[model samples]
Target chain A: MKFAVIVFPGSNCDIDMYHAIKDELGEEVEYVWHTETDLSQFDGVLIPGGFSYGDYLRCGAMANQSNIMAEVKKAAAAGKPVLGVCNGFQILTEAGLLPGALLRNRDLKFMCRTVQLKVENNNTLFTNHYEEGQVINIPIAHGEGNYYCDEETLAKLQANNQIVFTYSGDNPNGSLEDIAGIVNEQGNVLGMMPHPERAVDELVGGADGLELFKSIVKQWRENHVNN
Target chain B: MKKVKIYVTLRESILDPQGSAVKGSLTQIGYEEVQDLRIGKYLELTIGDTDRDIDTIVKEMCEKVLTNVVIEDYRFEIEEAN
Candidate 1:
């Protein structure tokens, strides 16, 4: 399946996401500028990490106002798999595609390191390849990765089995309940702070993240190739 | 012309790490009486005269871009431009 990596002005990880899909995953992927209003061509959308709009006014706040975000919402509504990492996750929350807001890290510092993430729910397409309650190493780099939502929203998330990943060891960013990643109610859209694309090559670190992309492709093929 | 002052702060329920750090620094500096601290954003906008109502425009701007209602609470005041 083909994918589109949304490229905002300050996005630094767009190339990494493209390389992960094109070189590692061996899938069709292209860099789509934020100004482009149409996203109907791609099967999935990946919002890569970076300080979009310099993270001004708040992380991912300004980027959410861009013209392309409206199209991204449309793509999500059409049942397309949308994966957002780091600043991309912030954008998803800001755009109301996913619940909760990513606040400044509890330590008020920019954290950059690889951390262990536990797969909380493997039923969704994004985490289907991951074994339930398995731990995988993934790198996270951000100044504002603390995720917060009201207790009611948290209850809803838990009830729907939307909490996909949680910090395995120590909570890197002090996200509520050690939440490292989550999917929307429909389970098609996922927002996570960890850099999965950065972990696709074993030469660099580990190939644990590659399965996420593979899972998406595998689910898409199962749903589309036969029908 | 009109001048609009906007203040944006995290909601009471959300934790403000920056504010907490500042408070810690204050404590280190021997300011023991300080009870709480909250860090927020302040923006001043100078708008030219327009047909639209100033209050309406400012409120719309705050809701749309100046603040995120999900985690932030925003308030604004308007004054005649100097």
Candidate 2:
């Protein structure tokens, strides 16, 4: 499936995302500028992690206002798979595509390390390749990834199984309920603080995150072939 | 020109670890009895003459971009200029 890796000004991880798709996944991938007004050609969307807009105002706040985000919303409403990692996750929440907000880490430190993530739900488009309750190691680097939501919203998210991943052993960054990743109510959009793209190769580090990209492609092929 | 001052703070329900760190430092310096502390942002905007109400503009900006309604609470004041 074709993928568009959205590149916002000050975004540093765009190259990694593009390489993960083009070289590792052997898929059609392109770097699309954040100001572009169209995303109709891409079958999937990936928003990589970085200090977009220099994390000015707030993480992902300014990038959420860019013209391309409107197209990202359109692609999401069309039921296309949209994956956002780290700062990308921040933008998704800021755009209201995902619920809750990422607050300052409980210890007020910028944490950068490999973390264990438990697959809370494997039925969603993003985590279907993994077994329920499976554990995977992914890297997380951020100063503000402590997720918080109102009690009512948390209850709703739990009832709907919108949560997709939780920290396995120890909750890094003190995310509420150890939530490391989540899908939207429709199960199309995913937002997570961990760097999956950074884990797609074993030569560099671990390749546990390769399954995530493969899962998206597998689902896309099934949907198209069935239709 | 008109001056608009905006204050944005994490909601009471949310935890402010940064603020608490500062509070701990305060206690170390012998400022005891400080029961609570929080940190927030202050922003200033200068607006040119416009037909829309200043309150309306500020509110729209605050709700949309200046403050994240999901995690923050904001208040603003307008200072009319000569």
Total backbone collisions for each predicted model: 0, 0
Q: Write one digit per residue (lDDT tens) for candidate 2, span A99-162.
A: 9989888888899999999999999888878999999999999998998898898998899999
Q: Candidate 1: which stretches are off by over 4 Å?
A: none
lDDT of 1 by residue, A1-227 (tens): 99999999899999999999999989999999999999999999999999999998888889999999999999999999999999999999999999999988888889999999999999999988999999999999998999999999999999999999999979988899999999999999999999999999999989899999999999999999975
Structure candidate 1, residue pairs in collision: none
What is the iRMSD in Å for candidate 1? 1.1
Best by DockQ: 2
lDDT of 2 by residue, B1-82 (tens): 7999999999998888888989999999999998889999999999999999889989999999999999999999899866
Any idea what lDDT model 2 has? 0.93
Docking class of 1: high
Q: After superposing the true interface residues, what Cα RMSD does each candidate give? A: 1.1, 0.6
DockQ score of each predicted structure, in the order shown = 0.83, 0.91
Q: What is the lDDT of residue B33 in candidate 1?
A: 91
Which candidate wins on lDDT?
1
